[model samples]
Target: MNKTGKIYVVGIGPGSKEHMTFEAKTAIEKSDIIVGYKTYIDLIKDMLEDKEVASSGMKKEIERCTEALEYAKQGKTVSLVSSGDSGVYGMAGIMFEVAFKDESHVEVEVIPGVTAANAAAASLGAPIMHDYVTISLSDLLTDWSLIEKRLHCAGKGDFVVCLYNPKSKGRQQQIQIAREILLKYKNEDTVVGIVRNAKRAGESIVITTLGDMLKYEIDMFTTVIVGNSNTYSVKEKMITPRGYEL
Candidate 1:
């Protein structure tokens, strides 16, 4: 009987090698095979020279995870990569589900990396310093009604909101609708920070008001941080104060 090899779910972090956790880097180096979405694989092409790579396009997550598990079962160390922390809207959960369904005994390890919220917030000067909620606008798997409910709750709770997968070619209307929902609770002047391609190439940061945010360019790579009532902008930076007295 061949010994099963381990699988590592790695988060590459915001398309920048510097943002990747040391553990994540080490896992990729140790893996005999690297599997991930094509975009994520391209982000780390420098590290994949000697490794066997299997990359596919969007919406093929199940196929990627299954392939990684298969390689692991064949006694090959496998690294399954995601752009952000794998557990947060990444491949870690799906990988676990696949492994469990197959009743496979291969060991699995998850390495965390800086997620988009963290990277975008840092680039915009701590817009998430207070309590925050992260939501993905993509409704590919999740129903749009469920996502709308989450947006309403996040808005009513006065929580700093971080939006992922904000807008794409076919998904342009969701963000617009989200703004309207958030406006019911937040002030029109509430500080909003938009970070595109955070911590990566062609990064752009814009600090605007909730009412004015829509005027800026936003897309799938952009992270939109809508501040709570108390959050404010200063010196071109968006900040949500933690209520510490000066």
Candidate 2:
């Protein structure tokens, strides 16, 4: 093992080549090794020509981070890649966690990128324009009780709610639970928008209502925007006023 090793936890933005920031590109181009999940690896495949790449798929996040640590320990400048912002439910946190546990590994530098929340908000006009609370409906890392509590709190506070990981193959009821929680403070006609595969090919924006969300097919790739009591749709675009109007 050499001694000049450093780890860069790079955010590749969402999924588009154009979304890849200049700083991210520079880091990848300069890295001695690139490590990430398979999807993230595929997303930046072209940028990794002639670069040593180690990609993991369907493995526990700790396992992936451990591999990245091993690569970095070998004195290789490594880039740990994550789709969307690396810190937004992404790999940056886990990588740092591993580093902290092992003093032999140096601290990691996290490079921020545009998260899905930002991209989804852009695609859906301004659904998250004002005060909004972003939450993930996935119960993997968080408990359902906490998610429900946040959903109700966000609804009562009239904050636009941005939901991530709304649905997946085995987890299907969390979104419905979230919908029920929001319905207490939101009207059935309250506008809700769904942005799937944001900034990627096959991107789509669906604007509907609190009641209509159940009728739509949602997946892990989707980002759901549930409007507050004051949210509305104009010209078929969802817009939540930030209260900046005079």
Candidate 3:
């Protein structure tokens, strides 16, 4: 315990031990306290035996980061965990912002992990091999109008689009609207990949087309990939070729 304890923002990937990176494991092992969402904390609970753990449900992100920083200020090594890459809609950025705003002097390190888009893509097929954009269909923090503009732009550019938080129990129409917007600019038969619970238990992947995407059930766990104009399916594998000739 010293005045200069360090904080590690670690990405744990999908809620599975297999997908958790070695760097994340090491950082957690070296930390004196663990802080993350309740679900993500449970993912590595076995490895955290006898360690101090602080977990909370959704909307507690700022509280969680603040607690971790306080623990670090007390000369404790802290691990702030996030699902997927910490920089991608995860805790790293938030932690840094809070640290800078508070003018804390603790060192910070970010460890990257496999993202939902990559994990889901591996399960379904390669739909983002070319120019692509990653967007979250949820309108919680972002305005719906802005999201719609981006969706329409992605469609116009024929960019392979990776969608996060496609749908949930309360908000089911965002993805449906996204599907409709893309349909206007892309072919009705454009390929779309749906993956639920990527890299975790009961994982499911479906390769369908733009016209039929709305028929499938989706939730926060699902990651949807809308293929570009050149994307196609070969033997159930959605491949977006990078212009390589055989």
Clashes of each: 0, 1, 0
* Candidate topping TM-score: 1
Q: Give me the displacement of residue 18 in model 2, in angstroms.
A: 0.9
**Candidate 3: clashing pairs of residues:** none
Per-model TM-score on C-alpha atoms: 0.99, 0.95, 0.97
Candidate achieving the largest lDDT: 1
Q: Rank candidates by lDDT, best first.
A: 1, 3, 2
C-alpha positional error of residue 244 in candidate 3 after TM-score superposition, expressed in Å: 0.4
The residue pairs that clash in candidate 1, if any, are none
Candidate 2 TM-score over all chains jointly: 0.95
lDDT of each: 0.94, 0.87, 0.91
lDDT of 2 by residue, 1-246 (tens): 378577889999986779888888888888999988888899889888989998888656898788878877777888999888999889888888888888654658898898989999889898877888889988877888888898888989988899999999999788888898898988999999998999898998899999998898799999999988788999978888877867
RMSD of each: 0.7, 1.4, 1.2
User: In model 2, how many backbone clashes occur?
Assistant: 1
Candidate 3 residue-wise lDDT, 20-121, digit = tens: 888999999999999999999988899899899999999899999999999999999999999999999899999999999999998999999989998998
lDDT tens readout by residue for model 1, 182-211: 999998999999999999999999999999
TM-score, model 3 to reference: 0.97
